[model samples]
Target: MDSNAMATDSTSGPTANETEQDGRVDEHNGPGKVVYEYEDPAYRVFVDTLNYLEPEEIEQVLAAYRFGEKAHQGQTRLSGEPYITHPLAVAGALAEWRMDAPAIIAALLHDVMEDTSVSKAEIAERFGKQVADLVDGLSKLDRIEFQSYQDAQAENFRKMLMAMATDLRIVLIKLADRRHNLQTMAPVRPDKRRRIAHETLEIYAPIATRLGLNNISRQLQDLSFKHIYPMRFRVLTRAVKAVRGNRRELLSKILDGIRSKLQESNIEAGVFGREKSLYSIYHKMVDKHLSFSQVLDIYGFRVIVRDVPTCYLALGALHSRYKPVPGKFKDYIAIPKANGYQSLHTTLIGPYGTPIEIQIRTQSMHHLAEEGIASHWLYKDSEESGADLQVKTHKWLQSLLELQGASGDSSEFLEHVKVDLFPDEVYVFTPKGKILALPRGATVIDFAYAVHTDIGHRCVAARIDHELIPLSAELNNGNQVEIITAPHANPNPAWLNYVKTSRARSKIRQFLKAIQQDSSSALGENMLNQELQALGVVPSEIPAAVWERVIRDSGKKSRREILTDIGLGRSLAAVFARRLVANDEVPQNEVSESKPLVIRGTEGMAVQLAPCCQPIPGDPIVGLLRNGQGLRIHTHACQATRKSRTTEPQNWINVEWEPDPDQCFDVRIRVTAKKVRGLLGRVATGISQAGANIEHVNMDGKKPGLFIDLHFLVQVSGRPHLAALMRSLRRIPDVVRIVREQE
Candidate 1:
């Protein structure tokens, strides 16, 4: 019988003594009493998978199935099958992994709460709390209104992850649910099918891989591939089958060789021929730009051994028989994958110079690789075999909580989760010899964040293999990294361009947002106070009622929000100040102009020196109140703002530089120098001698015949320092002309 078909077609009726019964009758049913006589074909087919469970446990699962069947009596799927069949199939899938009774029960009723009138309390009363919670976690947040489909999807994902964090079985059941959906997605519309396929291929497949459910992950990918690109999938499937047929003799020979070698070494193992999934084949072909022939590792062998030590012994035997390909061997047994998958992988040159891939691992490791967290019944507290796998899975789940807390919204949280799901890990080391596995292309900042969020926040530079490297440097396998942090150092916004890990990106964003809010609030308060003082009013003397009236009229939640809005330039500070004093019965004089705000270059996100002019201290400047973006400062003669100043006069605010600024400001300078050897070096040396650092250099080579125009973005303290640097550059004989550049 087809495994997926839930005995939907009736057969001969049950007979006396059960000799020729259509379905297997439970021996547990008392004499003259039949709890379930296979009347429900779905239940009959599903019962066959419960052989591993005790009689009472199977009865409980059957009970849940009956409840779901009754609840979904009138409902049918897109496939036109009774809705109960769907849950039964999901439960059967989980049962293949030997999941506990509660998980199976949850699977059997995963959709009741969402599609029917059954409540969580009712399910809890019927089955139990654990099963009810799993079903709830697997349910979608459809009833809760959201602005868009993306919002609803992100919220549902977030909710599911939170539930998974508490009990990992939720993810297992959810994966099974998704798997069954993909299998029966033909009846779904084409547009919806494509969307679901894309989502499954992008998200659920990677998630399954992360959990080390290699078998299920492959199935999900292949099913998604079939729906998303039916033509490619069909073409690829035919091609792979044809190739397999042509190489059947070669495959048998390789399998025989592996078996003989393992037996000769007395390594007692099971060697099986493995074929790459169609989706994997297509992925490899597209990713590597390879043709069918170029994908040499499409056919491989998996050697399952009795224990860890024998795995290596069998690998040696296989290598002794065939010439091992150079640099094609990996010892995952020593340092397992982040998902706790352990295998010794090697490639050998088979007959006719074709490459043969071989993976040798213990039977236990193989089981874990196939079933992932579901391989061991986590409900049982004392499963020592899966202890390491549980720990790794737990750590990943815990990070979801952290990401959820740090994220500003559901969509942002979903993006972070996606970033973490596709981890092609590269293992590195800490200074103290502790091994850390990070996603491929992860940088030093990612490492610091992986170590701890606080470390990532304060990280400045790193020493990789005892040599100082930039924090954005990509770490490699086996590199020992030591983070160099400073108490005063802050996360640079530019780090977002290179940090690969989600934790680092989220933490950096979180920190920058916090500092921005603080700075904007302070700036808003200062601006308001200055404006009030110009009107001869003291800010402190404003009564509570007056402040409340202004806040209410502004449509803001509290005083701090108003201040933040004002500081962010979303609201004019003068308008709010006038409103605050409007209700106050204070003696007021003609409102004189407010004193100019000082530009100290230390206001963090609240004050952004416009890149167009790159204003330095001592340069006359004006602040443009950009809505929601805080004050953008520009030099008085900046060409970029010249049109804006006249067109939007309300946005321009009076601003002046402080007498002494604590930080350097970037200024651009254009230098026309003779195109001669070492001319650029001499100019750089002159600028360095003048106490300025060149942040960037750009050469305008459009019409250069003998002279080259070099634009240098240099950091200087103030105008005097910039002038001195220009003077030093002018002393160079090759320098034709030098001018401070501005838009």
Candidate 2:
């Protein structure tokens, strides 16, 4: 049966063996004796979870469960079990993590909106708005049809994350939901299992890690690995078990040694050994190109102390006893990660010359390390600690919202978030000594955006450690960076090449999009004006009703939009003008005596001269009207223009340079000169004297000391100015020949 149909059926009534009582199932014998079954695993787990909550909180959770149970009454899972069991399992996982009553309750009702007829408003009235919002966030929109399964998944993830940003509890509930789903995916189809498992691995697991829920993240990874690569998982699991059996004595010795040393040092601590997860072990093997036997350090130790000071004492004692592996120690306690994980990590040469990793942290730190943002609830009663964590998480969420605002589409937003999910990071400092952690390989542009959007948009250069550096310079740990900004400066498209942060990329893309639209709008206006002139009618003389009709007919919003479409090459200005004048709304008057379209190099991005022939003033030029790209002016002699003229003569329009154009255009010239030390210098000096700037110089020395080919990219006002420069260069004694390079 279809899952949705099963879910709908489940909401009808209780099963044959059960009777409804106060929205719950009560077992009844033939003689009217009522029996409540407490032996079920789901019931037992829920009861166990209640032990961690207060009496009132427990009642609230139970109330939500009863409501959810009634809503999902007749629903059966793919495993043929009652559908309510799924939410109970999710709540059980969250309860295991000691989440607050609201979180647990939300988990129980997370699927109500998706599977049942319950509305968010109803849930809110029964529970609070917070719980309803969390449920709604976890619920999927079944009505929207996406282009592909991948698109649907990406969009769903995007929605979940946006909701998560508002209240982190949504993601906590989502992770719990995913964990339970993966745990019970045995009966699912292979293809479905693989797709869900891959998603769990790629999206959910990384988010769990980023949020610092290590236990959930690790479990998700192993479960995903099992489904995505079952053979490898089985092989690695067996290998780990065999190794554990062989190294039992060695692990015992190492644990005993650490415990003994901590006792001797008068440091009170709890020491235990833990084998790495199968997926992690496999990851290490693949990442390091090692065989199963070669992947050591699979077993690690965790030393939990009473407080921060004692954590250091315990670490020192352990290191003094074991041979420390050089460069394998990290003081995360000194510089906590963005997720607020604080621990000291060290690797040591243990018994049998094997390597073992160790983690040291206080009891509270250990809790935080395991739970991450969820620890906020663990210390919710403490205003200082919980509020600080909440604030940090909220700040990160706010940044995500900013990215969402800047992103052009859902896919782009998801792509940016994926880039932000990378765990590796480098901590850099500002000029004020404030440290800002960024992803590894993040450049100065990413740093600037991390500071502020305006600063990033205006940034032109940077100084790392008091040394001026390029904006693309990769930042390093502890380097103090100072961004140099100009008020009028804007983001360059080239900045996208090296920016590592999503925020930087999004902001740059947004700026470029805005600029493109503005330029296209302006170009569209010009093109339409030229078309109107060609039609022997003035724009002002065209009836407003005709423009309105054209706008309506073209499905554009307004005159400006139509023009922008024309400018962007989405539509032709001539066609639009023909539509406007179809009924002879404006009478023709001797071709309107229109002046030639003027060319000024200062058109910025709105008008571009084709690079093929590099048309300058005094060069015979024609404008090619392109869709979405405005007008592209080309010289008559350009081969590209000649080819396009034959095929698309209608796109061509008359264009001429403005008298005495003020801006310079680039032109290339080739010179063959005697290969000598002063030959290039003399040619450059001659060009400079003729009032032209050499933008580039390419020299070929295949026949050294005999003859050399020189290619110069020089800026000139017009063909006359270029000819003057070429004549000046030709007079040089080392010059054998000089000629303008043609397309």
Candidate 3:
């Protein structure tokens, strides 16, 4: 049995909670005193909240709490409370939200294994599988590691996001856990408090908002705000008090008027005046660098209704009573935020010209907005109901799990997640009248992709509200979108430079890279084919049965798969092809007589033509290896002698060109015009006429066109043969600058 529930025995090894509470008794006895209690305040509260649960659930939770209590016997928290008190408190918080049996039970055990000797299997065997999974989620990553202490914090944030993506409740439980710790944070060393506070402000608060837990979000924000900016938090708190002091009666009047208006309109609503949390106010002041007096919209009203339509009616009524601030209105009802919050938000100037923000939503939306992800658990009516809510929230929560699947690293996942978790949203409509929720500043491309990956990849154009626009055009709220897609269209590399969501970026990069690797493999295979054919074995002679046997021998996936592997330089194509070709079952003499293609340059050196000779494929060449990379092939007469070769002689190697190299090579040739008009075009024509593809040409006028070096990468034969080709260009009278890089 767990010790948190009613239990008798107190003797145990040292535990934080039980030990701290028994400190006084320990002083009388000695260190390591076994201190047991009748029942902790946290568990008492937890047991009290179990009235809504079935008798079985009550027993289950009670047993787990007691077991946890026993496991934590003699343990004390940093706050000197029984260590069981923390888990009990976490359970109490979840119970207050009216969570189901599993969650409540999980809360009771969340800290057991994380801070104690209890293992996940122990919890599973004692409680159940559901409870254990929840507990496991609340546990930190197996370990935290970093390149440096500074990076450890970043990794913590990284890990937290990764965990939250799978089970949002894990984060909620953590938040509740932190809230309790923060409440008792004074007992913790001061040095750690500020860092925790800053982390809370930056990560937890935003997540709370994303979860639609406004109440918790506000508290976490305020606590973090005070710690991160103590002076500012104090000043803002005082300023808010002063502002409310003068406007207390006016605020009452406004609240009363709103209440009265709703009543008169026959709309049931819960209306209340809300001053922004001190932390939020502090952040606003510091972040915007504004004075206390300048932050006029410090207080607002929240009007929660019973149904979705009532939310809009309430909004209309409020807008009529107060002059709305133009362009400040947002209708989240039609397009809920990424966090599943739905409402109508509008800012208005009251009779005193004070800007007041009003949020109108159904009671359910209000629940979600305030509780965020936890609202599902709190609002669940039964154990089965709680499971269903988990299913529902899981749909959203689980995406965090998949978001990281395609990401190259945790940081990539974090980037996409941060964007998706942004609190604000814009509602755009499809031409068919369906509303799609997109982040603010989302473009048509984002919308197209958000619909479906296939649609996104094939999207060529978009028509927004009957106007054709660029794919990257930012979509405005309420614009009707029509996507133009083509079956043949593929994702472009350019899309990667601007895509916002992690999904879109990952998918695009995956596709483009796959294509590139495919092409590379094809090129490598073709080169290997020519090499093999020279070995006198007909590739076709390799029967399918024999090819399969060879592939099995090589331990490769398949021929195409293997070819792609070789193209990416992952495998040696020459070696693999020889193996496959030798098993062809072809004629013996035919195989023996085939000649091997000679490749120039020593292995793993930089391949560059000797600029002095400008050697081509048909030219005799040698290989000279450079360090780190394979041998480089250069023409014999290339003027560029290696500086690294002489100094780093160990890096040098031999080189030679393939007798029949199959690929085109770029070589630069200079040409001088007779200063004739259109001479550049004619020179280009002459180069094109020489059976060589001109890669690039430069005809600059530094010496007033007296001479010009038009660098043209042209195809040619050996050094002597390329010399003859340049001699052919010299006959054109426009060839004033005739130098074949024989430097």
Global fold similarity of model 1 (TM-score): 0.90
- Write down the lDDT that model 2 would get: 0.81
> Considering lDDT, which of the candidate structures 1 and 3 is the better prediction for this target?
1
User: Candidate 3: global Cα-lDDT?
Assistant: 0.66
lDDT by residue for model 3 over 374-420, one digit each (tens)? 66556642234234435645665566666656666655665666766
lDDT of 2 by residue, 1-743 (tens): 12212453635222223333332222332222223344576675566556666655765676687777888887888788888888888888788768888888889888878877778888887789888888888887676998987778777888989999877888988888888888888888888889888888888898888877888899999999998998998888888889999999999999999999999999888999998999989888889999988988889999998877887888888889989999898888888888777899999988878898999987777777777777766654333444555676787788789888998778898899888887499999988888898999999999999999899999999999999999999988789999999999999989999999998999999988888778878777877788788778777888888888878888889987887788777887779878877866776666765566776855756688888888888888888877656678888888877778999987777778888988889988999988778788888899999999999998886755688899999999898998898888878888999978868
lDDT ranking of the models: 1, 2, 3
Give the clash count for model 3.
59
Residue 662 of model 2: what lDDT?
A: 81
Using TM-score as the measure, the top candidate is: 1
Summarize candidate 1's per-residue lDDT along 603-683 as a digit string, tens digits: 889988898888899898888988889989988998888888999999888888889887898999999988889877889
Please tell me which predicted candidate would have the highest lDDT against the true structure.
1
Q: How does model 1 fare in lDDT?
A: 0.83
